[model samples]
Target: MTVALAISGLQKTYANGFRALKGIDLEVRQGDFFALLGPNGAGKSTVIRILCSLTAKTAGSVRIFGADIDRNFPLAKSFIGVAPQEFNASLFETPMQVVLNQAGYYGIRRPVAAARAEEDFARLGLWDKRNEQCRTLSGGMKRRLMIARALVHRPRILILDEPTAGLDVELRRLMWRFMTDINRRGTTLILTTHYLEEAESLCRSIAIIHRGELVVNTATRELLGRVDLETLVLELAAPLDQLPPSRFRLRRVDATTLEVDVRRETLLNAVFAELEQSAIRVIGMRNKTSRLESLFMGLVQGNEDSTRAAAAALSAAAGD
Candidate 1:
């Protein structure tokens, strides 16, 4: 597989001596939709900033498509597009102008930049608002504007830090469709979001950082495979006073609802067979919790000290 981005022994220590990242090593394959997840102050932003050159690394090396970022700055940077968490675009500028301005920064001529701007604006559902001042747009619209601006350059790698933070459910799903389309077209995407469901749905692979350390890195499915048990809530056809006597671990959530812990090693069919033999008719069933969420919590827990330290390091760096 072609490696789009690679980092080795990456470390970042702030002026106050707080370490934000401790020897991080990661690789993102070309054309992969990857998620870089972590709790607040878990060095997610620090890693992004360092990659985009907004913040310099204290040590270690970074390579984009095999080119060292520090040594081949311009060449490496040209392959990257970063949409930071904050809305950094000029609020006074129109959506049309915002994208066109970003295109200019990439040295695209007016005619070419105008075409890309039109395409991106239309694609992002900002075509009608193209002429309107960004300040007049809603919070969600502003986020879309940043995405359009980032894509205007058509970079190979896109890094989005919380791209849909304040968006409503409808807008969030709309963005998800857009993200899927772009990734399918071969743009490598690195996404960081607090919304685990979004990451679970969009990314094929994930790397979670906790306490400024790389805690979990694997394919989404593989990491989920590490989940040992799933609680299935079954809806019964008739209200049962007691759960069916079965070898499976089971409990009654309510009169009609039964909770069964399905172990990874046990066949779900076996659980059903036990219920069937006991004469409990199951009308429907559903997961009691999200698999990805269960794994994420398990991996990131017990790192409160690192969390607080990472937070302080970020604050100190910002103040500096």
Candidate 2:
């Protein structure tokens, strides 16, 4: 498979001596919808900025579709488009002017740039507001404007950092649909967002960063499968005075509900059979944590100690 992006031993340190990334090794294959996940200060933005040439990396190697970023900065940058987390557009410029000017920076002639800008604006639902100043648009519209600006270049790989941060549910879903379409058409996507649920739904593969260190990298399905125990809440038809003392561990969540931790190997039928014996009629059941959220928390929280301990090593190797 052709690799869309690759990073090896990536790291970043601020002037105040904060290590923002620690030897992060990651790859996103061509035509892949990938997610780069992390909490605040986890270096997700730093990584994106480095790739876009906005921020300098302290140490590491980065390649965009086989072009080394350092040796072939121009060509490598040409193949990438980035929509950063923060808005950086001019308030006085209209949507059309913002997009057209962005296209001009890449040296596209006026006619071609205008056509591409129109296509992007129309697709992103900004055709009507094309003449309105960016400052006049709503928060959601401005977010879409950033996306349009990024796509105007038609780069092979698109990196979006928290693209839907302040968008409402309906607008977020709209953007998801648009992104999914482009990804299907072979535009490799790297997404960083606080919306874990969105990541769970769109990304086929994921890599999670914690405290400047890479914690989890795997297929989305495999990540969810990391946790063997699933806490399920079962609604009982009848209220029980107390849980029947038995081998099956059950917690009385409420008058009509009970909670149980079910191992992956254990069948739901087995739990049903145990409840049947106790005369506890089961009406409904649901998992306490969605599969991805369970795995994310476990992986990040599980690495808490190791992440902190790596600091000494990071400092020792800084001069390299």
Candidate 3:
């Protein structure tokens, strides 16, 4: 498959000498839902701003659908649509007008834009509120309106920056379904969200950045598999006064439940053997897979540890 968005050696430095992005490189395949995860001030937003032409980059290049963002700004921008972190619609304008106005900015004709806006609003469950001023809509409704605005132009790539933030669970799930439908229809999506589970479920690939540097970029499954540990949840028949001395280390999650992190070589039978010897009957057991949260924390914290280790090594060498 062809690359939908390609970024190479992307760097962005602010006037205050803060390096927001340090030569980040990423390739998003067409028709793929790509999630970019990071803590606040991690440069995820900087990348999105640069891709959508909202902010200028200090160095490097961005290409959307083979058209350079800087050189072929119009053509490249035409292929991209962005829904920013903050809602920027005119509060006084109706939902239909908000979308239609956005479509017009992309050079769509008024009549066609109006028709498309109506269709998108209805599909997203905002048709009934089309004539209501955006300020009159609830938070969830506003979020749906923003999504409709972004889709009015029907760009090939959609960049969503925390699209479901502040939304209720039901609304968030609805938005997820909407995004999946859009992706299934061959629209490439780039999502930046705090919800790790959402990223794990919606994105095929993930890229994590921290403190202005790219940390990890790989297939979501590949990244999760890097942990090399399985979480075993074992429910004991009764509360344990104390844990047994087993080959595998166990963590007491609750009175009756214990969480054991076991290596791949350690079989489930071995765990059962230990429990059986302790006279603890296992009522139920389940394995929890390594999630994005664990993988992300491990990478970022691991980098910190490595940096401290390097500093200590230098100190020791100097003492010699």
Candidate 4:
């Protein structure tokens, strides 16, 4: 597969001397659904900004489909489309105008831009609202409008930053379907979201950034396999006086709930059998957290711990 996007030794520092990205390297294959995730203040946004040519990198190289951003930014940008985290369309402009103007930025002619705008509006379920002012649309509609605007020029690679934020469940799923369809049609997608389930379910590969560094990059399933233990929340049919002994670690949540830690090697049937032997009836059960979420937290926390330890050692050395 062709590499759609590439970054090597990427570094970014702000005017205030804040190092937002610390020499990170990453790649996404053409037509692949990729997830770039990090907590607030991490370098995910910096990377996105650099790729979109919205911000200059302090050092390092970036290429979009083999076109270098520094040497051939217009060519590189021609292949990219970005739907940013915040709403950016003119409040007074109609959705159609907002999308058409975005197309115009890429030098798309008015007739062609209008046709593409109409197609995107219908695809995003905004056909009827296309003539209305952007400020009048609901939050979810505004999000969809931004996505439609990004697609107006028909860029091959789409970078979505928190695309589903502030959306209802139904609308979020609808957006997911639209994104999946585009990816399936050979458009590469890059997504950043705090929704672990969305990343785990939609992205083929994942990269996590922590404290301005690339922490991990691998297949979603491979990252998820790192989780050795899964917690299950069980709703009991009856209140318990005390907890029953079992091979799996179990903790009481309330009079009628139990939290059980089941290792990957243990079968869920074993848990049910143990509970049955103790006459504990589970009326309902679900995972305490998504497996990917558990692994992500562990990686981020471990990175933080290492950073703190290294800083402490440096401080002690200075004192010595």
TM-score: model 4 vs. ground truth: 0.85
Candidates' RMSD to native: 6.5, 5.2, 5.5, 5.7
List, residue by residue over 1-320, the lDDT tens digit for candidate 1: 99999999999998899999999999999999999987677898899899889888999999998889989988888888888877888889899898888888789898988898888888888899999998999888888888888888899998888877778888888888888899999999999976677777789988878767886677877656655567889999999997666788899989999998886798988888888888888999998864456545544575455545543433343342
Model 1, residue 29: displacement in angstroms? 0.3
Report, for every candidate in turn, its global Cα lDDT versus the true structure: 0.83, 0.82, 0.82, 0.84
Residue pairs whose backbone atoms clash in candidate 3: none
Query: Which has the better lDDT: candidate 2, or candidate 4?
Result: 4
Task: Tell me each candidate's TM-score.
Answer: 0.87, 0.89, 0.86, 0.85
Question: Which 10-residue window in model 1 sums to the lowest lDDT?
Answer: 311-320
Deviating ranges (above 4 Å) for candidate 3: 239-245, 251-257, 264-266, 284-292, 297-303, 306-320
Candidate with top TM-score is: 2
- Tell me how candidate 4 scores on lDDT: 0.84
lDDT of 2 by residue, 209-269 (tens): 7778876677777655654556899998889889886666689988998999777787878
Rank all candidate structures by their TM-score, best first, as comma-separated numbers. Answer: 2, 1, 3, 4
Q: Can you write out model 3's per-residue Cα lDDT over 1-320, one digit (the tens) per residue?
A: 89999999999998898999989989999988999987677888899988887889999999999999989999998898888887788999999888887887888999989988888887788989999988999878887887888888899999998888778888888889999999999899989976677888889988877777766677777655554566889888999878888778888888899999886577889889888998988999898655345545544465576534533332343342
Candidate 3, residue 67: how far the Cα is off, in Å: 0.6
Clashes of each: 0, 0, 0, 0
TM-score, candidate number 3: 0.86
